[model samples]
Target chain A: MAHVGGPVRAWRDYTDGAPPPMLQAALDCFVEHGYHGTKIRTVAARVGLSVPGLYHHYPSKHALLVSIVQFAMRDLLDRCESALAEAGPAVEDRFRLLIECLVLFHAHRSDLAFIAASEIRSLEGEARSEHIAARDRQQRMVDEIIDAGVAVGAFGTEYPHEASLAIVTMCTGVAQWYRLDGALTPEELAVRYDTLARRALA
Target chain B: MAHVGGPVRAWRDYTDGAPPPMLQAALDCFVEHGYHGTKIRTVAARVGLSVPGLYHHYPSKHALLVSIVQFAMRDLLDRCESALAEAGPAVEDRFRLLIECLVLFHAHRSDLAFIAASEIRSLEGEARSEHIAARDRQQRMVDEIIDAGVAVGAFGTEYPHEASLAIVTMCTGVAQWYRLDGALTPEELAVRYDTLARRALA
Candidate 1:
């Protein structure tokens, strides 16, 4: 299922840019205690700031969450677009690259991705809608690839939309269980996932 | 991919046993505000009890969460075992039934499943180990089936463990997105997933 002709980029090389100091602290606290369990004070304390000082930057706990979510989504989408551009025109190749991108991001950025997945409920109003829209955009990338693959007989799955969703969900879920100390590297896991995904489509 | 010899059970018919009043209220609060955000007093208030009164049945907020998680895991494992037993001896049949059972459990008991998946971090001590063990038991069910299928040449995937994890992850993820009011019913989604899973194995 891997692209045979070209050099596959190292999965570790693609990353959701490192979060700033405050957001990194917030991510740590949120991952440890969850969104609701985390306190603005704790986040402030982590960064050696008073509550009022932290407020000068993020304004609210929700704002901190919004900033983190936006960063995660933008970084993921940017990587997906770049992977596609680098993957050339074959739909199958594009599909493999997208899967690798998703699996690697979820595995490498597990904490940030975990907060994004588990804390969607904490986001409200405009943040919630924008987050959902960003998620939908990610879904659409895989959807279009599968649709194109099927159109050209490169993939044979009858339910392209649901197949795309299943593929994305499985990939996104790498955040929930993947461990850096575990048996597989992000690169190996990405290969395993891409192979399984391509076989499913076949 | 669906079984053809006998009447396939309705996805709606298999259900997690409902929680009584207090646990249900706790589940609601946890789902809405999260485990950390929900107060013991608020759960007591929802059930018309004082803090001590609610504590009579469950000692702490963590206890309530453990109860819910235990219930969710027990119910899911029981359903999966039953689905496999009813599926007879065919590896393909067992695989399809297991996928349906997982999809149905996640879609029908989404709140309970969501809490179980998201709040594993909140579980402490023995409860955490027990929850992990039960989850491994669920994973093992799929793992063994895929292993058997691969051993018998009924499924062609080279990576059985990885494939099973991908299948289970995608199916379990239904809890995050499936809705009662959505375009597809649980049964329809189950069939679609079964088709996708089977094709992936093929």
Candidate 2:
């Protein structure tokens, strides 16, 4: 189920063109202590800057969180797009690619994944709506993949939408407990997840 | 893969007594705002008791958290034991039974699951070690099941431990996002999850 033939890139490599250090630091702190528990000083300290300096980059703590969330959402969508493009003509291949991308994303950017999965409720107004839309889009991608698989008779499930939710939930949950120092590398972890995802739909 | 059995009573239900109301209130507060973010006054307010009155039951906020964690861990292990005993001989049936028990456990006692998953690290000394041991024991149960499945040639996986971790992580994550008013009941959710789990191992 692992995607063959690909140029792997680290998260930092992807962010070099337009880095958001303050947002990244804020996300790390938020993932560690949650939104309400994280303080501006802690975020600033993580970036080796003063609170005022961090504020100069982000207007407020809430603003920092909002920016971080938006950033992660956009990043996830971009990865999804790439996976869709790289995935071959086979529906099963596309499905496997999507799950592998999700696991890889969670394993690599766990701090961002944690916030994306858990902290959207803390956002307000347009920010919250935008994040929700992005989340729905991601969910829709899973739905579409399952629908395609079902159409091709490659997957067997009574409820496609619920199966999609279970698959996505199982993949996203990787962020909570996965460690960089664990037994498997991110790529290897993604392969294992791909197998589980395939089995889930089979 | 559904377990063919009636509902099994958990240790908590068969125990001699209920927990102190104060501790229940504390668990609710901790689940809502988290441990570091929760205040004694807030718990007191929720319970309709003075701060001093609340302290009469538990000496400190940390003490309340410790009590909640201990209760949750003990209850979870007891439930797992009962589910295993009731599941009978089939590996798939046992796995489904365990998943059903966990889904019901998380549905009725989400606060406890949340506290056990998130706040246990805050505990110190023997309290912390005790919680860690319980968590490890739970992981071991899943590990043993997967190992048995592999030995019997009923499950095919290159990485059983990783697969087990994925399954446990997925089930535990339901507590973080599932709502009572959602489209599925706890039983429905369990069935859906069992399907996904079976696919994952197929």
Give the winner by lDDT: 1
Q: Write the per-residue lDDT of candidate 1 for residues A154-181, one digit (tens) a residue.
A: 9988888778889999999898778889
Give the alpha carbon lDDT tens digit for every residue of A52-87 in model 2: 988887889889878887788888888787777777
User: Candidate 2 clashing pairs?
Assistant: A199-B199, A200-B199
Candidate 1: count of backbone clashes, pairs at least 3 residues apart or interchain: 1
* DockQ values, each candidate: 0.77, 0.52
True contacts kept of each: 0.83, 0.57
Which numbered prediction scores highest in TM-score against the true structure?
1
* Tens digits of lDDT, candidate 1, B68-129: 99988988888788788888999999999899899988888989988998899899999999
Q: How accurate is chain B of model 2, given as a TM-score from 0 to 1?
A: 0.87
- How well does each candidate superpose onto the true structure, as a TM-score? 0.93, 0.87
Global local distance difference test of model 2: 0.77
How far out, in Å, is residue A107 in model 1?
0.9
